[model samples]
Structure formats: C-alpha cells, structure tokens
Target: MQEKIIDDKILEHMTLENVFKIINDNIFPLLNEKEKDFCRELQEFCIELHPKIDKNQDVYVLFPELGKRGYMQRINLWRDFMPYGMKSEILLATHLSCLDSQLELARLASGILCGNPTFQHGETDEILKVQDELMEGSKIGCIGITEPNRGSDAVNMTSTCRKSDDGSHVIYNAEKVFTTNGPKADYFATYAVYNQANPRGTMVQAMVSRDFKGQLITNRLKIPYVDRVHIAHTIMNEVEIPVNYILGDNGKGYTNLFDGLVPERLGIMGSGLGICWATLAYAIIYTNLRQQFGQNIINFQGVGFSLGDLLARTSSATALAFQAATSYDDNILFAEHPSKEAEKWIAGVSSQGKYLVSKLSADLTYTVQQQMGGISVTDNTDVQELSSTSYIEEVIGGARNIQLLIIQNALRRYSKLILS
Candidate 1:
C-alpha cells in the first residue's frame, strides 16, 4: 500500500519546514483549539531564533545564563502552558535539540526527577525557590549522584551526608566528577550516604546549595563540543545546608532519586531525536546534490539502503521514546513511596529506552556522516555536533553498561511476576 502523501512533507531538504509540519500535525493538534495559537507562535520563534543551531557561542558566555535568575521562568512558562502528554514531551525535546538549546535545561530535567516544587518533603519552599530560579534561567541545577569512584553506580556511591551535632544541618563531604551544569548550578539535588541515621551510611539524596562556602566547582572536563554545557568536578569540603535541604526523607533518598530516571532519559531521548532528524535530513540533501557515476549518490543502492535503515531506526526510536514518556506521564510520581507497579514500568522504559535510543542515534549520525565521506569528519559541518554529542549522551546520564544492568534487573523482576 502507498504511504500517505502527507508523510512526505518532512523530506524537504535542509530546512525547518518539516519540523513545523510535525509539530502542527502530529503533536500540537493533540492539544485543545486554544493552544493552537501558542503552537503557531512557538513554531515561529523556534524556526527563526532557536539558539543552539543558529548561534555560535563560547562556554564562558553560556555559563552565565545559569547564574542569571528568571531565565528558566520564560522557558517554564511554555512548559507549564503545554498539557502533559507524550506528544508534548516529544515536541519539546525534539525542538530543543534542533536549536542546540540551553543545555542547562537538561540538567534541570534530571534534578527535577528527584522531586519538584509540588513533590519535595518539608523543603518545598526551598525547592520552589531553586526551581523557580532554574525555570527563570537564572540559577542552574545538577543531579549529583555520580562520584569519582563509581560513576552512575548509585548503589555503591561513597559520598556521605551527616547531621550536625545540633541536628539542624546536613554536612556533605565529597568529590564528584562529570557533574553536568555543576560549575554554574546554584543547587545540586545531590545523593550521598546518610550517616548517624538508621541503616547507617545508607545513600541519601539532598540539596547542596552553591551559596554555601567550602565547595569547589571547576570545568575540569574540557571536550570539544559540550563545553558550552559545562561538565565540572565538584569538591565539597564540609559543605553544609539545613536538614530541610534533604529531598523527600533521609533513608528514602534513593527512592526519591529513582523518580527522575524516566523523565531524565526521556528528555535526553528527545535531544537525540532532534539530532537524528537533522542528521538524516542533511544526509538526504547532501547525497542528492553530490553526484557520482553520472547520477546523484542517493540513487546508489548502498547509500539509499543505508538511508532507509536509518529512517526505520528513527521511526522505531520515536515510537519507543513516546511510549516511554507516556508511561511516565500517566502517574504524578509525587508520593513519598511509589508503588512497585509504577517502579517496574518506569524502570523498564527509562533504562531500555535510553540505551536503545542513544545507541541508535549515534549509529544514525555516524551513517549520515559516512554518506558524505571526507568533510563529515572535519569540524566544518553540523554533522560533527550530531556525531560527537550523541557519543557524550551514550555515557551521559548512565553508561550503556549501567542501562543494560537496569534492563536486566527489570527483566528479572518481570519473569518473577509472570511465574507468580
């Protein structure tokens, strides 16, 4: 059967024309008629002014935005206006990645996974202040789970948080590496082992304020592309915040930390989706323009088949990512104790979805570059951004190996459920 003619609208070469179509047709229409105008306005602003792709910026300039307050408020305005749905998630993520968006937002997305304004225990006010600052784009945020010894191995992490003698404060002492948005982050939803509490030395999640002294934050990991999104090393020398800074409760820190996995990965997946779209689009245009053997290179079976495979992968990833996002959006996930059923579903998608999408995106970007051959390798083309950034994401939130382990654990749980 022939595919619908409308599906071909996105195939227009090297343009945002198709992106506008998808947002209008597949995504925005899902909203009420009242929102159509908002979608229209957003499409206009994004097409002309999305900063990531259109702007050439240095890390120094970008980092300041994190310190500037009220920036996230503007971003959050749209986020709040949009109804929560898989379509909304997909559209926002896909669009953000297209423009090399404010990378700090991704970090905030991860921190939010811990708990947001409506969810945090007792410290809702502080979280709200930080969150408000983050949404306003003045204050940056980071998820401080990874340590120097065990990256993403949250279970075996070594940092510790101890209550002060007066029981009024939580003191943190540790060093963390690969802290995304760290140098600029005003607050870190950090995970550390809880000392002098039940289940002694149990890992707990807390909010570490940058305003507090006795902390070191530096841009130690200097890579090529993502410096604009600073990944720094953080050294906490008796960094202290009130016990209220603790997210959720002390012993349940890990569980609170777990809440973010699905959303965080979904956000990352969206960025990957946008990159895949751009990479594939660019390759399509490039191959058609460049000729070989008296015809455009796109006519060759080798090139054509590769492109077809990439399309298949991108489509499959879109389906999987949306399904994952929907699974998460179904539940508010604010309860101090989440149900096992929710945990199972969230675990399944966040781990497996992130692994599959990031890997596929990396592969697709690589294939697109190969079609262009030589120039793809040089920094001259945007393909370099897709190529390098995808690699960073593969290891970003969690490594491929860690994701595989989570997937394995989730499968094990599923098998027991089936047998029972």
Candidate 2:
C-alpha cells in the first residue's frame, strides 16, 4: 500500500469533497451508506433550520406538539441507531456535527445507553415500554453524575440512596451540577452513593422520573456560543423510585456506568473533528479568494503555516479518535472482564483523544478566526460562530483542568503504556 501524506499545500489545494472522501476512506470506513445518508440529511437539515448559527432563535423553536423536543426526534436518528451497540459511537459524532453541542449527544447517550433497560442484558424489560415514549421526541433525558464540588472524585460522593422499609424502592438525593438537558429532561440517569450505615459510600446509579416530588432543575444557565441549548443545575430531595427503576443496581454499578462513558467521550471527539474541518475549510476558501498584495493570502508562508497547523492538528485528532473508537469496537465492545491493563490502555487513548481534540478545536478555531481578521467577528460569519462555539467545546465534555487530571491518572494507572 502506497501511503500519501497530506501536507499543507496538498490539503490547501484539495477540494473539501476530496478531503472528506479521504476521511471516509481512512478514519471512518465503518460508516455505511445508510449512516452516511443520515449524516447528510442531518447536516442539510441543521443548515436549513439555522443557516446562520448566530443571532438565530430558531433553535428554541420547538416542535408544536413535542413539548421541549427539537428536530432530533423529528428525524428519528436515535430510534434508528440506539440499539446497534458499538456503531452508535460513530453515529453520535455524525449527529453532534449538526447539533450545536456535545451536551445533546451526552444527553441522548445517557438515555439510550445507560437509561435503556436492555443495556443490562438480553431479557425483555418493562421499562422499555416506558422509554418507548422517548422515540417520538416528546421526552428529553439527562445523565446525572458530577456534583458541584466533586467531578473527578465521584466515588466518595455525599449523595445517598436508601432502601425503603419494605425494600420496594430507594430514595435518591443529590445535587447534580453541569447536567446537560437538566432543565427539560423528563427522565434522568441519576446516581447517588449508597450504604447509609457509612458516611462515605460507593456509587449507585438509577433512572429517575421528572415528576418525582423533590425533583427540580432549580436554575438555568447558558453556555457561551451554544446558548440556545439549555444547561442547568438540579437537586433531588429524597426522590423515591421503584427498585426496578435502578440501573446497574448491582454492587458494581460504577463499572456498568463506565460502559456508557466511552460513547460520550467519542461523541465529543466527533464534534471537535467537525469544528476543525469546517474551520480549515473556511480558512482555505477565504485565503484563496480574499486577495492581498496582488496575490491570494494562501500564497503567503505565514498564512499557509496557520492553515497547515490547523490541518495537522485536526487530522491528528481524527486519527487518535478513530483509533480509540476502532479499538473499542474490536477489542473492548464484547469483552467481559477485560484485563486491567486493557481497560487502562483504552482509558489513556480515550483521554488523549478527547483532550487533544478539544484543545485543538479551541486553538484551531481561534487561529483561523484571527487569520480571517476583524470581519471574522461579525455575527453573520459562520467562522465567527464556529470559533466561538469551539471555545465552548473546551469545557463541554470536561474542563481542561479535568482533562489534565485524566491524563495524569492514565499515566499513573498505566505507566507501562506511557513508558513503552
């Protein structure tokens, strides 16, 4: 096999279509025709829905009868892809590109991967009948894990879960912060520390309803650039749910919860890749068409270098992300009790992929925006909106500090991989 390196001028000269085809050929060959077509529709739909991402209230315009639901339900991508297992990670990134933020992907994954009753096994679950209502887009869902004071340290949580007198149900109480879809989610994959006898406890995750007595979103806040999507903090005050509602109720709920994290991180990787690809595309077009000094700006070494740098970072991020995804698909997807070494290695790859992509997104977008000059800041410029939103991507999955923490943890837990 002859290897063709995509250098600065090579990428600069190539058409966007050719670039994407290369991406398909190498990184995402697993994407089938049906999934490709769905991505096209989603991209076209989002463009049509809010052609100009900024200064548009269209994102807030809900489907007439769907309550708070947006176009995700109208398209039915979740229902079509949720049950597929490993492939859902790839499709999720495709989905996030059209959608504004990683929050939506994480929220949907929380429901589809974690909240879905069938995630535990092959048996039929009555909960499936209840969540079937979600297929239509009438309901929104969220996953609650991180508290305001503690994010990385989730195991030593203060939240508590206690069994009722007859053991028919458990009471869940926690102040879950940075919860995506928190304000509007009708169902939540919530977690609390169990073992009332001890002040400190291990994790216990559950699926809780919105109508529970003490359930409330409490406050609403907007994340910059993607302000149209709601982000909120929530509190569960002694919320009670039937024991059956518990997800991964076994003593090892934390282990089960981890099965869903891969998809969320992969989804963020997809979003970052999309942002850089778009930024690189815009930079290429602008430099080619926008004349300076009687020649195109792309001819200049400095401008070309910036574009090349963005291209290099974006491509690297894609490679890392795809490697992690494919590794999971092939090695970890069906493996039960994967060795600690295998788990640690996968975690390292995932963290590195996510961190590099997120940091690259923020850097790439900002550099391209600067290259475009002041005009790039105008509200109508797609580059400006994308650049601004790319900044938000830095903290979407995890804050940069937390990303560093993940990297450090990976090194400590899997020194063999790092030292190799």
Candidate 3:
C-alpha cells in the first residue's frame, strides 16, 4: 500500500468525524428491521430523557418500569441491531454517552442536591437475569462499591457476612454511603467480608435485588444547578442471600473485582473522550463565530493557539481510547494474559486523557462561554449548561488526582521493566 499523508487540518476533521462514525456505524448495522424501529423509539425516548438529565426529576418518569422488562428490551434491541461483539462495544459507547449526560446533570445539580443513590436491593441470579433483560432496554446500571469508611480501601471493609448453621444462607450487615443510583438501582452488586466455616479469606460479592429487605433512604442534601437524584445513606441490616448467590468462587471476590476494574477504567476513558470532543466542537463553533475587533475571535493568536492545542489533545486522547478498546478486545479474544505493557499504556494514556481532556473541556467551555459574555450564565442558554457541566468531566470516573496516581504507577512499572 502507498503511504498516504493527510494534512493536519483535514486529519483533524476526519478524526472528529471518524470517532462518531465508529459509534454510529457499529451500533446501526446490528439492528434488524424491527430492532431498527425500536432504536427509533429509543432515540425519541432519549431525546425526552436528555432534558430530564438536568436532575433526578426525569428518572422516575423515564424509568418507571424499573425491571428487567425495560432494560432487556433495550439490550435486545441493541444486540439485534449490532453484531455480538459489536453489541458490547456499542453498549460501552452508549454508556459513555449516558455518563456524559449524567455528569452534565451532576454539574448542574451539585450543591443543589446530592448525587443519585444506588437502589437498596442486592444482586441475585434472578436479578441479574432481570438486569440482563432490562439492559436490553437501558444501557446504565449502578452498583455500590464505596462504604462510609472504606472508600478506596475496599479490602478493609467493615461489613460482615456470616453463614447460617446449615450453610443454606448467608447474612450480610453493613452501611453503604455514596452509592450511585443507590435509591434507584434495579439491583446492587454488594461486597462484604464473608466469614465462612473455613474462613478462607475476607471479602465476597453478593447480588442484592431491590425487592430485598433493605432500605433506600434518600438523605436530603443540596447540590448546585440541578435537583439531586435519590442518593442515600444505606444500612444493610441482616440481609440474607442464599449461599449460592455468590458471584464467583468462594473467597475469590477480590479477583472478580480486579477483573472488572479494567473495563470500568475503559468506560471512564470513553466518557472523557466524548467530553473532550464535545468541548472541542463547542470551541470550534464559538471561536469561528465570535467577533473581536474587526475579525472573528479565532483570528487572534491567543485564541487560535488555544483552539489548536485543544484540538490536538482531543484527537490524541480519542486515539488512545480507541487503542485501549482495541487492545482490550484483542486480549479477551486470544485468552492471553492482558499485556502488562498494553495495560500500562492504557492506564497512562487513559489517565492523561482524563486529565488533559478534563482541563481542556473546562477551559474550552469557559472560554466559549466568555466569548458569549453574559448570555453564557443564563440557565436557558445551551452554552450555560455546557459550561456548568464541563467541570464534572474531571471528577467523574476517577478524579484528576487519581489519574495522576495511575500515571505515576504506570511510569514506575515502565521504568522497572526497562531496568530489568
């Protein structure tokens, strides 16, 4: 094949379009005729859902069924439209978009209300089946991992899990704080310190369904800009799950947790990339339109330079995210141990992407808002919402500081590898 060299400006435009096409093309082809029709329905529903994203106000109206029926319908539609593997890819993309939506809402709602809570019920096989069903309908599911005292240090969890005398059931007791979708989740993936007869280890994963005898107490709190979702402080008082309800091998819950983390990080990176793209698009339009002196504001060296920098960073971040996704997919296909190098690169790139894109997003939004002057502050203006939500891109998934930690860890590992 001949070497092709594309100009920087053309490459930038192509990259932007390509990222969106990746999502649209992957998602659209998977649908059959009926599923395509269902997708239209979902698109309509999503349009309605978008406005309600300002706060938790619309979740009840939008997610009334709150069962497998709704989620499964959507998941089925998605799967039917996309290839099997592509379904998962597109699902991740949809979730990234949803997280961006949620993060936008959080920005508007923060300080006006607290974050949304996870629903109180635990995860069960039945619930998982239901969730699988509902996932076809809905792309998002919330699980509570953080407790009051054990935020980052999940291994030091104080929650206790004890087996019944005959080992027929297990009782769990713990308090959970800051459970996202806490008051609204269909089911919860809960963790506790399980004490078995042999006491092989600490920690276990349990599925808790909403119907379980647990409480979803929405603690009243104020967030800024938007109304809060039903975030709660939860008490799991003697909740019993059948012994078989364990998500993985007994005493091996930590392994499962670790396994899940890579995907979770990838999901976060995807969201960050979306935010970066949105911010870039916003800046491009604003800079081209806003007039300062006799020419468009983009004519100024400072403004043009900033836009150029942001554009480059956004493109790079997106490429990193795509590469990570591809690497993850390949690793799974080959049943190979995840490439330590790839993982490290992903961790580093994702962390940098999160940081750069987050900062760039905020800067671009604020600058664009400044270009609009006072109108940017008005609640009714689209830019106003965009500006308010920009800060949240940094905080979601992992905070900027956390990303820095990940980058440092990756660097240390890379250096050790070089020396060894």
Candidate 4:
C-alpha cells in the first residue's frame, strides 16, 4: 500500500464526524430530543470550526464566533438561546471541549468565571453593560480570586482593598496568579480584602475593566499545554473600581466567592467530562483500525479490556456530571424558590464529581495514549492534545486536594445529621 493510502486509512477514523458519531451514539440515548438536537448543532458547529482554527493563535480569537451562537456561556438566558440552564451549559462545555479543549478552557474563564458574577450579583447598569459585552464576546473577561499565597485557601486572601472616603470607589492592591484569560481580558472579576485578619468580614468582589484608569497589569504565564489559552500573573496597583462595579463588598464578597465556586466546579466537570469522552472516542476509533500482528489492535484482549474499563468509567462520570447539572438546574439555577437541601447536597456532590472526573480525565487520557501508541503521541492524532489538557484538569478550578478537602468536610458534616 502507498504511504498516502496508509496515512489516509488511519487518519480517516479520527475525523470530527466519526468521533462525533461515536460520542453521539453512546450518549444521545441519555438526552431528550431537544438536548440531542442541541448536541447535533454543536457537532455541526465544531465540525465546521475545527478546520479553520489556527493552532498557534489565541483562543480568544474564536470568542466572537462563540458569542454569536450563545456559546460563550449557557448557564443563564443570554438573548433567545433555549434550554438555558446548568445542564445546557454542561453540554455546551462538553461539545466545545471535544472540539478544542483550549478554546473551551478560555471560554469558561471569560464566559462563566467572569461573566457569571455579573448575573449572580450585578444589579447596576454599569455591571450589566459589562455582562452584555462579555456574553457578546465584544469584551473578554477573567476571574482573579487565586493569589500567589492563596491557592486552596481562597477566602482568606491577602490581596488588600480600600474604600474611598466618599464610598464611590474601591481601590485594590492585589497580585493574583493562575488567572485564566487574564492577559487578554477586558474586564476582571476579581477579589480583595480590606483587612487580612478579617478577610471574610472585609472582602470585596469587583469588576475591574482594563481601561478603568488604574494600573491593572497582567503578564501571560507560560502554561505550555494550553498555549492558545492565556493564563496570567495579574498585578493590580491602586486599581480604583467604581462602587457600582462592585458585585460584592464587605462580608458579602466572601459569600459571593463561595457561591460562584459550585457552578465553576460543575462547569469544569463538564469540560473534563468532554476530555474523557473525546479521548475515549478517538482512541476507540484509532485502535479499531490500526493493525498489529495481522489483526486490528482493538481485538487484542489487553487493548480491548483496557478500553472497556475506560468506557465504563467515562460513562459513570458522565452520568454523575449530568445528574449534578440537572439537580443544580432544578434546585438552583432555574428554581423559583431554590431548595436549600438540594443546594447543600449538590454542593457536596459537585466537589465529589469534580474530584473524580478531573483525575479520571488525566488518567484515562494517559491510559488511552498507551493503548493507541505512537500515533497518539504525535499530532497525527488528538490523543496527545487531550493528554496535555488532562494534565491540568486536576490542578484547575482548585486542585485535586481541595476537592478532596471539600468532600471530607462534607463527610464530617454527615456525622451531625446521622448522630442527631
């Protein structure tokens, strides 16, 4: 066989159409007709958009396209997009992640991380304008909660803030790290504290625009895996934000910060779940076609069984993510009167699901790479890219240890309920 023919034979299975077909075949049964239609629409969009992407360019370049389609964020009703809720958001994240994990990461940061605060806490015209800009992708956004000294200890932040005498402006002096999309963001949904000793009592959450007439500086951090996605080391020196831009001030910032994390983690779960499915789908396609010892490699007991194990685990994680999203939608996002009990339950479950799925994304990608061999490691296939994304999954949206800590804290609480 000619080399061209051979290359075509192996590469054909890795096409977006085939991969989407596989994922759709597996998961569509779980979705209703409308949800399935949404998936198909995403599939078509991804299929069309995938080929045009410049791998070296910034992911933000695609933000306008996402905004046009209401793909920037799906959790809230932005424009006329239907089925706007947590589950829809999850599906959107999943499809985007499968299409391009880096783009999805940047979108989540801009759309959900930054834009979400506006929806959740913003009550002023100024903040709403920023929200519209972010959702429309006319302006990019990022969150600045994680600081140099505070990774998992997010609430007790050292970044300081001061309110003006007239109370019309809040000044922030903060150095934040691990800020995804920060370098290119036009607005920052950032946090700071008035008193370090009383962070919870004095924290402030504000939407700081890049042109806010303050020294809001950002330098891109070298996260080599998702080079298209910009993570930043942000330094805010006397950045003065108008009081109206403050989403949460005083002790309310602490509450708002924690409130945002549940959905943020759930969104990450959606992204990780996509990585799992994409890795599995691509590996499955490649293994079933690549020949070894005069037989397709997938027929071998070792490869087949390993794929089986990954399949089962990915399906279970998908179920967990979908269920959590559904419950969140029912009890929180779309709730007329949100159920406190369900809220409490979903919070714990989000931590648990985030922990499981994030680790699973890393593990399964590596395992599937091993199963698919050299082609997977090369750009000839997407396994290597998926693996790159997986490596960061455990670290983002709070590290694996933080998720475990949340789960453990929830476990400790069970003692009181059961004992009572």
Each prediction's total of clashing residue pairs, residues at least 3 apart in sequence or on different chains, is 14, 0, 46, 0
lDDT of 3 at 327: 62
For model 3, how does the per-residue alpha-carbon lDDT over 221-263 read when each residue is reduced to its tens digit? 2435323344446667777777645664356666655545544
* TM-score of every candidate: 0.82, 0.78, 0.70, 0.97
Model 1 has how many clashing residue pairs? 14
lDDT of 2 by residue, 227-246 (tens): 65566688888888787667
Name the top TM-score candidate. Answer: 4
- TM-score of candidate 3 against the unseen true structure: 0.70
Question: What is candidate 2's TM-score against the reference?
Answer: 0.78
Instruction: Tell me model 2's lDDT, rounded to 2 decimals.
Output: 0.60
Ranking by TM-score: 4, 1, 2, 3
Q: Give each prediction's root-mean-square deviation over alpha carbons.
A: 6.5, 7.4, 9.7, 2.0
- Name the Cα RMSD for model 3: 9.7
Candidate No. with top lDDT: 4
Ranking by lDDT: 4, 1, 2, 3
Worst 10 residues of 4 by lDDT: 1-10
Tens-digit per-residue lDDT, 86-190, candidate 4 = 999999999998898988999999999999999999999999999999999989999999888898898889999998899889999999999999999899999
Q: How does each model score on lDDT?
A: 0.63, 0.60, 0.50, 0.90
